[model samples]
Target: MALFTNIARIQDGLLLCSDSDEEADYTKYQNYAKQLFQKLEAMEQKIDKFSIEESEFTYHYYIANGVCYLGFFKKNYPYRAVFAYLKELEEEFRRIYNQQEIEEANRSFTFIKFESVIRNLRQKYTDDSSLADKNIQQLSENLTDVQRIITKNIKEVLERGEKLETLNLASSKLSNESKVYAIKARNFKWRMWWKTYSPLIIIAAIVFLVLFIKFFIW
Candidate 1:
């Protein structure tokens, strides 16, 4: 079980950089995380802090100085510890990298070197023993109340992006099925036309033949 699933830097409603836990299944969680990130971006103007709850995990995020820091943790994990870890990450990131460098980056995971820091911090926080440590307890006490932070469920977080993907997929499937149905309908119509008109044409041909025999052959 990975404690921290992802870390990202977002600015001006765009994801500037990101890193993910390699040991975990990236495919399974990336969409969920991405959806949450988008939600954070949408809500950034209204609120600077919040948590998004999913079935198996929770996304905690903090935005400051035009940079957003996000983290993913299991639902049972301590909320204070999660935020504390993120705060530490933000401070370290600011200390090491300047704002201009982050803003100018044009690609995902532009600060790929930061993954090493993320891994080290994840190990320290994931350990059960750290929860009982006096320093951690003090840190939790000093942290802000978890209730004060805005909370949104997974459906609400995914309401836009994930829903759009699902809708697009359904639409594509319907389009293909509609094409098939159209072909079937056209074939059915052709069959009906042949059934209704073929016998009349045969009778007409026979009548023409009889007329020719009487008028010319006789």
Candidate 2:
């Protein structure tokens, strides 16, 4: 069963719109969603789509055109189905909200009108009808091996948010070290070549000098 769906701008981690399910108390999950958005923001667009498992719920998300479409579902729900749901939402969102509107928005829920579209699509996939199930199976197969998608526990994700800056600094240090190693390797190669060929080069020069004296000076 679908629990909730939220769409946000990936660049600034600002909510754009979502399904307004009034019956469920999703406050806890909403907090986690906020932290997850921060994690995504720090990731610098490394991963666009993924899932996180916490308690008995799983969040499946997809990022396209700088917007992230994410949803929540029961742990037993076919994660593939959630991904299919996100894909449909992405298309509907792009059709309704142009690039300029998506980029220019300065506040959350700028296009709250998309909530109705989200509610309808969520129902379409989560329904128990045979056709809906079959459609989920077929459409989601294209997103093959979603089970292999990066799934992390809530603790790891939240804690890693603090460590992302350190990781980035370490990455920059490693890159600089790599460049130094490359320069050293090139110098070592040139030195070995000089050591191997210097004797032959010196002999060639001596022979040319001797020939000049024998033919011309003598």
For every model shown, what is its TM-score relative to the native structure?
0.59, 0.65
Model 2 per-residue lDDT at 116: 88
Q: Candidate 2 regions off by >4 Å?
A: 128-152, 162-218
RMSD of 1: 25.2
Write model 1 residue lDDT over 1-218, tens digit each, in one string: 13454545544345554656666765555676665555444444555455666677876666667677777777655555565566667777788889888778777667878878777766755543243455444534543333342334566535544322211111223223324433433454566678889999999999999999999999
Candidate whose lDDT is highest: 2
lDDT of each: 0.57, 0.67
C-alpha lDDT (0 to 100) for residue 169 of candidate 1: 16
RMSD of 2: 20.5
Total backbone clashes of candidate 2, pairs 3 or more residues apart or in separate chains: 0
